[model samples]
Target: MSERDADSDDPGDDAEELAWETTGTEIDYTCPGFDVRRDDVVLPNGTETGFHYVEEPQAVVILPLTPDGEVVLIEEWRQAVGRVNRGLPAGSAEPDDDDLDAVARRELAEETGYEAGSLRQLFTIEPANGLLNSVHHFYLARDCEPTAEQDLDFNESIRVSLAEYDDLLSDVLDGEIRDGRTVTGITRYELADRWQ
Candidate 1:
């Protein structure tokens, strides 16, 4: 096993102590969707900046690795992200969903027309700091049971695809999989190596 920094967020912080300090305390701003905050800080180079931040919700993603080592990934045309990329079956944790597992199963079926026999928590990712605070959760769902129903987004021109277990790693390493949540899910699946 490779030893990594305990705090992945502050990896660069160890290289040099922040030769700066926050002159102004963090102040919250009333906002919709996600709240924003500002902090006046002096940089290590002695420059001041207003560190504006935002709050985001926790997201859920599913890695449906079939018994044959084929992984279930979704290809959706995301307007916000501005690209049609491949990713694991994923969705947000909406309030009153009541059943996270059910939500996961529903998303899997809706996005890819596949249902899961079982689910397992794998890992999470924090993609940004400036204006996003989202926990991208990963899970493994195997032995999926496909359904006849397809309820994808209206503008979602999604095409489900599969990648072999071995090729999966290479694709991720070569930056072929650019979606952050999906990348985290793949790495999580590799970490335990449960399917192989």
Candidate 2:
């Protein structure tokens, strides 16, 4: 038997006992930014099934703060949502992107034309682990300032803006800002006691 199977037989190993064994995997569809993958697996109860999820590269989300303690935000058209969405600067890592900090800086510049004097990771999370096999690295960027023109992707339509940090927090608490990544990054930063 495999090591996993052997471990599952241990009486106290609840995690191993509940784990599903992947029998096979297949790509169901492919798109520009992501792919749908289906995995055939055997459940702990001996039932077989297939699970589908989005397969994509890691991403970075930035909460950029200017020297005056304002938060830099972006308003962009999100086709899937069919409306303009306001959020923090974020993007998927490109193939050539080796460092996550560099990716965060690049995305912040590309989306808002801002450069950060210092960048520190806030947290990492899988926003939708059940539906998407994607990870988002959250960052807190300090002393950001406008330094260059936006280098947005061909499909992007974005507008840059700044809001007072307290006001931004209020908006988030008031349900005015609905973007998931933005909400997650903002709340995480706020609760960490490091945003001030």
Candidate 3:
């Protein structure tokens, strides 16, 4: 078994230290979505090096469920990936957004035209801990109902659909659901055993 699977509990006690202290940082490039930054760092053994990473604001992914237990999924064309991505409804948190829950509510409505009767944070994850500076917060949105028309960006092409929870799970397990955040969110939500 792999190291992660081998340890059912805390593994930090036996893990090697690979921590780095950032001495300085600079933004190498910036774009509409994220910025690439270079950091001057001192390694654990006092060796200095440069580390590059992508930085972005925190984002939220909502697993919206209809009253009948169907999951709301989105198929969006992602220019970076050069194909349509199948995943949960997600978006970046706006500067003025009240909090993570508020971001989830807003993104749910804006992307899928659905409003959640009850929303709760399921978990948060860093898709790329080594190379990205962003946290993806996953929310479980229940009793969702159609509310308004999708308010999408000019570059967004999102097709929303409702799928049975089991079907969604099957897709994730069978490799049809490939989005990192989506797979992580589903795994966490199911592991919680709170599906209703």
For candidate 1, the 10 contiguous residues with the lowest summed lDDT are 1-10
The alpha-carbon deviation from the true structure for residue 51 of candidate 1, after best TM-score superposition, in angstroms, is 5.4
Task: State the lDDT of candidate 2 residue by residue for 63-110, as single tens digits.
Answer: 999999999999999999899998898999977788999999989998
Q: Which residues of candidate 2, in runs, are more than 4 Å off?
A: 1-12
Better structure of 1 and 3 per lDDT: 3
Mind giving the per-residue lDDT tens digits that candidate 3 earns over 1-196? Answer: 0011224334585454655677888989998878888889899899999988888888999999999999998899988889999889999976577688888998999999999999988777768867787778889999999987799987789999999998999999999988988889888888884645
TM-score, each model? 0.68, 0.91, 0.87
Best by lDDT: 2
Task: Give the Cα error of residue 23 in candidate 3, in Å.
Answer: 1.7
Ranking by TM-score: 2, 3, 1
> Number of the top candidate by TM-score?
2
TM-score of model 2 vs. true structure: 0.91
Error of 3 at 11 (Å): 8.5
Cα RMSD of predicted structure 2 = 4.6
Q: What is the lDDT of residue 97 in candidate 2?
A: 80
Counting clashing residue pairs in each candidate, in order, gives 0, 0, 0
lDDT of 2: 0.87
Say which prediction, candidate 2 or candidate 3, comes out ahead on lDDT. Answer: 2
lDDT of 1 at 152: 77
Error of model 1, residue 151, in angstroms: 1.2
